[model samples]
Target: MTPDEVIAAWDQPGATASIHPTRGISEGAYWASGEAQAALLAQDIPAGSRVMDFGCGDGRVAIPLRALGYDVTGVDASPNMLAALNRHAPDLATFRSDGSDFGKHLGRRKFDAVYCLAVLIHHSHETGQQLVERLRAVVRKGGILVLDWPVADEPAETNAWIGVTTWSRDQQDQITKRLGLTRLDVDRPWAVYQA
Candidate 1:
């Protein structure tokens, strides 16, 4: 599905629940390992650094990071999802934008670290590349970009609520190389890159 279609679907009633039936909220709200992510992030980023949660759905990562004392801003395409996040983290800054572009919503602001977790699978390879380029532009020099997506031996497509695409390790490597990003770590689907 197109990004617009995906956003429309997420805005529908119970859409968050549908994506995370057992958790009863979007995956971001109660995803396991929030502490682990926080710990990992703290190793490189100091407390109170500015962070951006790209494709932040329902404040799964942003809230925990905020509680850890980092200033966080979340950007998402679904108003319903952002509303859910607002209810949970009322003080957390948020903006409405499809994951493909951040400058359109967040102008000249740059982040110390930007994370796009479990959100890129829904985009096609072309769109994912575009998103990486846009995200790179918003990250400060020597900043971090953390991305998580399902890994496959070859590029593959799936039909869930919307069409989802997975990129292979080689594909991901090429993307990072093309963007002139240095790969810092790769724990399977989760890869950290430095700008």
Candidate 2:
């Protein structure tokens, strides 16, 4: 999807607005800092990892990652969302950029990890494939990619992946292969990739 398409559809209303029905989503948004720490704790996510949260809303991950002392930067298209995030995480640094073009905000700061949780699913799988390419470029070699979204062909109105396109196992394998990444097991809610 082009920037305009993203802005019009998802960024404006096409993307996952927020996780509803999931009690955790509410808790995380309210206490983003703690939620980040708890979520990362279960994973192999390292301390001091340079992290980027694409489409970070209210710093649900960004705030906690920051609290953990990871060099974190968040990018989102909504000023309202960013403002809400800033309110909770005042020290948080953010940039208003669409997911399609994060280069200007990123500059030369390649991250140790790049995450687009349910963010890429806003577009079609073909577009998601392109995003895999773009996102891979933002991370240093050997970095991790935390790609998350529900696996299905169609989008779900209540869930994050609803109405959005997604990858089949074969599609995922092919794209990761081209990027020189190895699939590390799907962690239910999120897909893990190691470059």
> What is the Cα-based lDDT of residue 81 in candidate 2?
64
Residue 18, model 1: Cα distance from true site in angstroms:
3.1
TM-score of each: 0.87, 0.77
User: Model 1 segments beyond 4 Å from truth?
Assistant: 21-36, 162-164, 186-189
RMSD of each: 2.8, 4.1
Candidate 1 weakest ten by summed lDDT: 20-29
* Tens digit of per-residue lDDT, candidate 1, span 1-195: 567767887888877765543365544445655555666766666678899888788876688888889999999888898998999889899998875556577678799888887677777777777788888788898888888766777778655544558888888888889888898854534788889
- Each prediction's whole-model lDDT (CA): 0.77, 0.67
Which regions of candidate 2 deviate over 4 angstroms?
1-6, 9-19, 23-38, 153-162, 186-188
lDDT score, candidate 1, position 16? 74
| Cα displacement (Å) at residue 182, model 2 | 1.2
lDDT of 2 by residue, 77-166 (tens): 767668768887877778886656767776766888888775666666666677678888888888888776556664432223334555
Q: For candidate 1, list the clashing residue pairs, or say none.
A: 28-60
- In lDDT terms, which candidate is top? 1
